[model samples]
Target: MKAFNIEDTAMILIDHQVGTNTWASTTPLELLQRNVIILAKFAKGTGMPTVLTSSQETNVNVQGPLMPELQEILPEEFAARIKRQGVVNAWDDENFANACRNTGKKNFVMAGVTTDVCMVAPAISALEEGFNVKVVCDACGSTNQIAEEMSWRRMERAGIGLTSTNAIVAELVKNWASTAGAIAFPLLT
Candidate 1:
C-alpha cells in the first residue's frame, strides 16, 4: 500500500464526545484525548480537509457535546460538524457521508470514541465504498480489550489499514525539515 498523501487524505473524527469518553476503557481517556488533539493539530496545520461528526450531542444525557478542544483547534471544521440525530453509523447519516464525499478525498484517517462502534462501522463502510481507510488505533477506544481487538481484526479483514497517531503524523510529515513536518513536530512533543 502507498503511504497516505496529504492531498488525498481526509481526517474523519466521529463521536469523540464527553458522554462517550466515560465509556472508553480499552484506552485511557487522557491518552485518547491527547492523541486525537495531536491529529487535529496536524490536520489543521497541513490544511487537510477534515470531517467532524457527533451523534446526538444535544442530548447531553446520551452523547454530550464534542470535545471542547476540537472547537479551539479546528474551529472551522468543528463549526461545520455534522451533528447526527441518532445515527449509530456515521456513514449512514447522509449529511456526514456527504461531508466526507464532498472533500474529494480517496483516503481517510479516522478515530472515534468507541472502536467497535463509532470507528469500525464507518471505517468499514468507507472501505466498501472504495475509499482507502485507516484507523488511528491509539486515538480510538472501546469498552473493553476484547471489543477493541475484535474491531481491529474486523477492519483488517475488510482491508482497512490500522495505524497510530504518531505513525500517521510522521508518515504525512515525512521529515522535520519539511514545512508540514515543521508544523507537526511540535505536537508530538
Candidate 2:
C-alpha cells in the first residue's frame, strides 16, 4: 500500500480490555501494552481519528473498559469509543462501522486483543468491504502461538497488510521536516 496519509487514515482499536488481556498469550502482556500505548500516543499526537471498541460488554464473563494505558493517552474528545451491545467482530457493530465510515477514511490501521478473533475478524471484514486495512501484529495478541500465526496467515492471504508499530509509524511520518513527522518522530525514537 501507499504511505499513510493522516487525512485519509484512522486507527481502530478493538477489544483491548482488561478482561480480555487475562488470557492473551501470543505476545508478552507488558510488551503488548507498551506497543499499544506507542501506537495510541502516535495517533493522539498526530490528531488521527481513533475508534475504540469492546466485546460482550454486558456479559459477566468478559466485562471491562478499554485498556487504561491506551485510554490515558487518547483524549476523551478525540478518541471516539463505540459502545457495541457485545459484538465480537467490531465490523458487525453498527456504531463501530459508522465510526469508521464517518471518518471518511479508506485506510484503517487496526490492532486488538486476541489476534484470531478480535483482530482478524474485523480486518478481513473491512478488507472485504473494500477498505485498506493494516494489522499491527506486535500490538495484537492471541491465546497462543498457533492462533496468532493462523490469524496472521488468514489476514495475509486476504491481502491485508501486516506490519509492526515502528514500521507503521515510520510510514506515516514519511519525512522528518513535515509537521506530523516533526511531532511523531520523537515519540517513535
Candidate 3:
C-alpha cells in the first residue's frame, strides 16, 4: 500500500537452488536468473538486510546448491544462508523464520525458485504474521503456467502483494540522482 523504505524493508530469497530451478517452467530460466541477480545486486548495493535460504541443498539430487551468482554478488549473506532440511515452507523452519525476524524489518521483498511451492507459503505466512510482504513475481517460476497462476492468485487472496523486479527497483530507488538510485539504476539495464 505504501512505498518501501530501505530502512524498513528486508529481502528474503528462498530456495533459489540449482536443482529446484531446473524444474521451473513458468518463467524462462535465463530470465529468472537475470531478474534474481538484479534483485541481489540492488539489495547488496543498498545495504538492505537479506535472508537467503535453501531446502536440502546438500542433497544435490534434489535441492542442490543456491545459485552461484548469489555468492558472487552477496557473499556475506550467502555464507549466512539458512539451510533447511526439506522444509517446503521456509517460514515453517524456525531458523529461517527467525533469521527474517532478526533482521528487525517489517517489510519483506521475497522471491524464490518455484512460485507454487517455495514462494507461496512463506509469503502468506509472513503476511499472516503482520509483515508487509511483496513477492517479486518475475523473479519466481513454477513447474507450469497453471501452477504459477494458481499460486499468484492464492498469495493475492492472502493479501501478499505481487510485484516485479523492475517495479521494486524503481520503488526503492525513487530518484536516479539519489545515492541508492545511482547504485541501483544501472542494475536495471
Candidate 4:
C-alpha cells in the first residue's frame, strides 16, 4: 500500500454529533467511536490541521459526545478548516473544498457520519481532483452495516484508499523518532 507523509496530510471529521450516536446503523457505535478517537488523537499528536463539523447539532436528532476527542486533543484555539453545508455529501460545500485547496495537503484522511454520503462524496471528489484520499473505515459511522459496506466498496472502486486508524497514523509518522512518533506512539497503543 502507499504510505503517506505528515506534511502531505490533513484530517477531516464530519458530523459526529450526539444524534449520530443514537441512530447510526451502518456500524456498531463502539467501532465508530474507536476509529474517531484514533483519528482525533493522531491529528493532535501530529499537528495535522483538522476540521470538525456537525449538521445542525442543535436541530438534528443525532447526539455526539461532549468534549469529543476532536475537541479535547486539539489545541484550545484550533480553527475550523471548514464548516460544510448540511447536504449529505461534503463535496457540495465550497468552504470545505477551499479548505482542502488551501492546505496543500495531498493526503486526506477523512471520517464522518452517514458514511455513504459524507465519506464517499468527498473521497470521490478528492480522487477526481488527483488528491490522495484515505477513508478511515472504522472512524465513519452510518445507518446500518450494509450501508457501511456499500460505502466502502464505492470509494474503493473510485480509487480512494481504505485504511484503519493505526495504519494511517503510522504511515504519517514513518519513523519511530519522528516528532509525531513521540506523541502518537503512546496514543496508538
Count of clashes, each model:
0, 0, 0, 14
Question: Per-residue lDDT tens digits of candidate 4, residues 1-189?
Answer: 477888878887777765665456766777777777777877777778677666555564444342355566665513563444356666667776777767778778888777875678877987898888888877776777788889889999998888878888788888879778887788777
lDDT of each residue in 1-189, candidate 1, tens digit only: 579989899999999998897788899989999999999999999999999999888889977999999999999999999999888999999999999999999999999889998999999999999899989999999999999999999999999999999999998888889999889889998
Question: How much is the lDDT of residue 41 in candidate 1?
Answer: 90
For model 3, residues 1-189, the per-residue Cα lDDT tens digits are 788988899999998998898788888899899999999999999999999999998898987999999999999999999999888999999999999999999999999989998999999999999999999999999998999999999999998888999998889888889999888878887
Show the lowest summed lDDT stretch of 10 residues, model 1: 18-27
Residue 25 of candidate 1: its Cα lDDT?
89
Model 3 misplacement above 4 A: none
Residue 112 alpha-carbon offset, candidate 1, angstroms: 1.1
- lDDT value for model 1: 0.92
| Candidate that beats the other on TM-score, 1 or 4, i.e. the better one | 1
- Per-residue lDDT, model 3, residue 43, is 92
Error of 1 at 43 (Å): 0.3
